[model samples]
Target: MVERRRFSRIIYQAPATIRQGGTVVEANIQDLSLHGLLLSTDGNNAELNCDILADIEFTLPSSDIVISLVANLIGIQKNIIHASIDHIDIESIAHIKRLVELNVGNDDLLHRELEHLSDLGEHLSDMGEQL
Candidate 1:
């Protein structure tokens, strides 16, 4: 298989809450990237659906700032949940960017990832307009 990942993932472990409709599940973030995250949940897999969007809330490590975003539950394998961020507030994105920057350690790579994310967002917006 070819590597198709556009963003660098940082190994960040943190407790997170995923809320979809009336169901709320506690999960641990296994890794984080600009566009998505890998989460590990206990036995609450039955409560989540891949077709539904979920609100994920977690605080930055050792900080009081909470990062919240709406994500699409893309896939699940055993206890691991794969989530793709669909919508995030400006503040939350900023926090995530900083976190990635600190962990990635390469300014050029981070810039490239940011540009890719911007381009993807523009492309999606244009697609929406065409519809």
Candidate 2:
């Protein structure tokens, strides 16, 4: 498996059934990534480059902030909706990471990056490991 630079701070997922113009469809998100997400919607039946997309809102369990994101359906598997984020930014990534650290505490998950923070000095002092 490839090492992920960012991880999902998933709170929950619900069935996303949307309609635009005159068409109706339903789909689900299997997993979410930092830049994009894995959708399992009825996208396989779509043409090579379909633009049928929608905007969705979801809340983060930590901050309870409902972030609305525009997404595009990319692939499909057995009626599952597979989609990706239309646009993502580094600021959003950092916000999610900070929320995770705040809610989950600064244990293994937070300390995983200690090796990279060695130059920060403070974390080095906390770890009781002298440089």
Candidate 3:
């Protein structure tokens, strides 16, 4: 398959909860990137283009990271629900980026991406140096 995303995606699964209004669904993150995340869930199909708030929590090999954000439901295939991040705070963004960098296991790629996000004023600490 041809890669078309504007941002690099890290294949990582973490437990999550999706909430829209008063409805809540348990889910798991199938993949994640700076712009979005794919959620796997068994709940009823969400309305297309609907916005939902979610809390994703997971422990890394070394640390735990939790992210809270509003996202737009973009697509659904089988059990996978794709959502584009509609809102995320800077601190959560940094933690999301760090989680990707750590799980991706690539120093050079993480370095370059950090430099790019940094240029855009969304800088996260480099895990490259620590590795």
Top TM-score model: 1
lDDT for every model?
0.95, 0.51, 0.70
Off-target runs (Cα >4 Å) in candidate 2 are: 1-28, 40-49, 88-131
- By lDDT, is 1 or 3 better? 1
RMSD of 1: 0.8
Q: TM-score of every model?
A: 0.97, 0.43, 0.67
lDDT of 3 by residue, 1-131 (tens): 98776668888777777776666677888889877888887765453335445444444435555577878777777678888776778878888888787787887877787676555443323443455
User: Candidate 3: minimum summed lDDT over ten consecutive residues — where?
Assistant: 120-129
- lDDT of each residue in 12-126, candidate 2, tens digit only: 3444444444555555555554334554565533432346665544455556555556667665555555566654344554554565566656558555553333344366476
Quote the positional error of residue 60 for candidate 3 in Å.
6.2
Error of 1 at 68 (Å): 0.4
Task: Output the TM-score of candidate 1.
Answer: 0.97
**Tens digit per residue, CA lDDT, model 1, 1-131:** 99999999999999999999999999999999999999998867787989989999999878899999999999988899999999999999999999999999999999999999999999999999999
> Candidate 2 — what's its lDDT?
0.51
